[model samples]
Target: MSLIIIGSVAFDAIETPFGKTDKIVGGAATYASLAASYFCKNVKIVGVVGEDFHQNDIDTLNQHGIDTTGLQIKAGEKSFFWSGKYHNDMNSRDTLVTELNVLADFDPILPESYQDCEYLMLGNLAPQTQQTVIKRLKNRPKLIVLDTMNFWMDVALNDLLETLKLVDVLTINDEEARQLSGEYSLVKAAKKILTLGPKYLIIKKGEHGALLFHEDQVFSTPALPLAEVFDPTGAGDTFAGGFIGYLAKVGTINFNNMKNAIVFGSALASFCVEKFGTERIINLTEEEIAARVKEFVKLSSFNIA
Candidate 1:
């Protein structure tokens, strides 16, 4: 069994309060697959890039034990590119540019080997694209986690709702949760969203933490406080990658494991923000990852006298 990640794999030019970059390797699958490679050995990516995407970057994924057979590189075309500048707070940003070149007509094609997918991470993309991937799968994965944003809800809501029904887990930020469920109270929002689809809903609260809702149970995972945040570009995708990667490693799916997965995912996300692009996550050691995860444990652990 393998873990499969499906989303955009393209270029990004980011400018933050700390610094700026011209164009670096980015995209949802790029972050998620790299984070997942640290946990799951058999990780594969399904995405489309253009001639502009470098082979060295593709080589990077292969070095991390990620399979790229499913990645389609179109000739005589440019890859999807995005440019954004973050505010002083490092939370809000303004879009400088967005060119959906090869991505405009992406067709998710699965390889025969990927048919044994036990875990699937559908990173943020068009709802119909995410849904198409699910339909193409030979057999239903043991678990399917879908991550989306307010953009989908604003435009392709019907498709997003239909895609929600095909996933076991749904991950969205607090504002998106409110928009999706039309309830201010997260608890109430979660209750209403659960009826639409998804056995579990994770409401991500950027700086504060993340909430996992399943039935009457809710698990809140704390976010690590960082001294400096160089970039926040791919943090959420890294979180989703780390989240699903941990679950695939443990080879189990349940409420208890989901809580722990959130912690593990948050740990990876903390690393993501330490530097731009995949700088921090790419060179992580097992001891370093273990220590980061321990920090989460200590941050949350307490006892009454």
Candidate 2:
């Protein structure tokens, strides 16, 4: 099964208590594709990057067996760039810079081969752009997972709502969920949001882990307690990647399978924060991932009489 991921492929400059970086390859699609590649080999990315984007980064993606056919390279334009500094708690951050550059006018053009994708992941992008990709597809993907943030809710609520009706799942942070539904209670928010369209809602709570809501059922997966978090950049995108990748690999969407997918996603995201940018996730081994998953099981498992 092939998974299509659409979002920005850009540069990022990050600062944390441990250290800082000048500029590194980072973006929603970049992290998502890398994380997804671990579970699904047939991962295709659709994003645009300026000439400033490096060939080595592209090669990194290729090494993981990801298809870059839809990655557009613009000659004169600059790639999107974002710079941010994380607070000591590693839970909040201040945006230092955001240069939309090529991303400002991004128009996703799905390659012909991508038309038959069975799994679609619309990473954080403009709601209109996300909808465009959906409309362009010759056949609706078996599963469509959408990730968004408070920024869209604040600036483009109407557009976001319109696109919501077309997706199968929605992934957002706790705060974003509350804002989108105008309900402080997550259970209530999930119920209201489900009425908007997506049957599944994943409310990400950062260090607290994630919650999966579908119909009348709810599953909570706790975050792996790390000794330290180096940088939280791209963790959420990595989570989304691991999630959809697992589902694609298993070829099932039931609640039991989704619970396992959440664990896989959390395991991958735990590795993402151990090192700056995508360093840790890039070289992750199957054995390492398996060990991390075991830890998650131990953290959340208990026998019931």
Candidate 3:
């Protein structure tokens, strides 16, 4: 079975307090696929890039054991590119540039081989595009996790709501959760969103950690504190990848399994912020990942009377 991820695979120029970069491989799919590859061996990607996207970049993804058979390369067009600068807080940033070249008209076409998908990670993309991927798949995946943002809620709200009906899990930040549910309290928000669609909801809290909600059950995990956060870009996408990747590896769906998945996801996301773009995650080792996951365990571990 394959763990398929669909989203943007393109270039990014970033400037943080620690350093700056010209153009690096940084997109929702790029980060998520890389994070998932560490846990799920049969990881695949579905995305489009233009002539400007170097072949070396595609090779990099392949080197990580990611199947790029579904990746489309269009000629005579520039790949999607984004540039952003982070503030000292590292949590906030300003978009310096956004060129949605080939991605402007991206029509996700799932290859026949991708029909074996058991786990699907829908990275941040337009609500309509996300819906199209679900409709195109011959068979529904065992697990379908959708990652979205406030942008979609502001523009294509109805489409996003409809897409929610097709996904089993939904991942969004604290702010987005509030915006989507129109409730200030996260508990209330989770209830409202759950009613709308997804059986499970994950509200990402950045440096603070993440929360997992299903029915009347809720699990909260604290974020691993880091000395320095070089670049916050793609951390959420990386988390989503690890979350679904771990789930795919376990080959099961339950509240307990989801809790363990969040720890692995947070561990992967912790590594993502240590450097710019995908620099840190691309070179992670088994030992390093295990150590990080252990650290997460210690953060919330304790004895009860």
Is candidate 1 or 2 superior in lDDT? 2
Q: Per-residue lDDT for 1-305 in model 1, tens only?
A: 59999999989999998889989999999999999999999999999999989999999999999999999999999999999999999999999999999999999999998999999999999999999999999899999999999999999999999999999999999999999999999999999999988999999998898999999999998899888889999999999999999999999899999999999999999999999998888899889999999999999999999
Colliding pairs, model 2: none
Tens-digit lDDT track for model 2 on 1-305? Answer: 99999988999999999999999999999999999999999999999999999999999999999999999999999999999999999998999999999999999989998987999999999999999999999899999999999999999999999999999999999999999999999999999999999999999999999999999999999999989999999999999999999999999889999999999999999999999999999999999999999999999999999
| Local accuracy by lDDT, each model | 0.95, 0.97, 0.94
Quote each prediction's TM-score: 0.99, 0.99, 0.99
| Candidate 3 local lDDT, 1-305, one digit each (tens) | 57999999989999998889999999999999999999999999999999888898899899999999999999999889999998889889999999999999999989998998999999999999999998898888999999999999999999999999999999999999999999999999999999988999999999899999999999999999998888899999999999999999999899999999999999999999988899899999999999999998888899999
What candidate 2 gets wrong by more than 4 Å, as runs, is none
- In candidate 3, which residue ranges exceed 4 Å CA deviation? none
| lDDT-sorted candidate list, best first | 2, 1, 3
Model 1 misplaced stretches (Cα beyond 4 Å): none
What are the RMSD figures for all models against the true structure?
A: 0.7, 0.5, 0.7
Give model 2's TM-score versus the native structure.
0.99
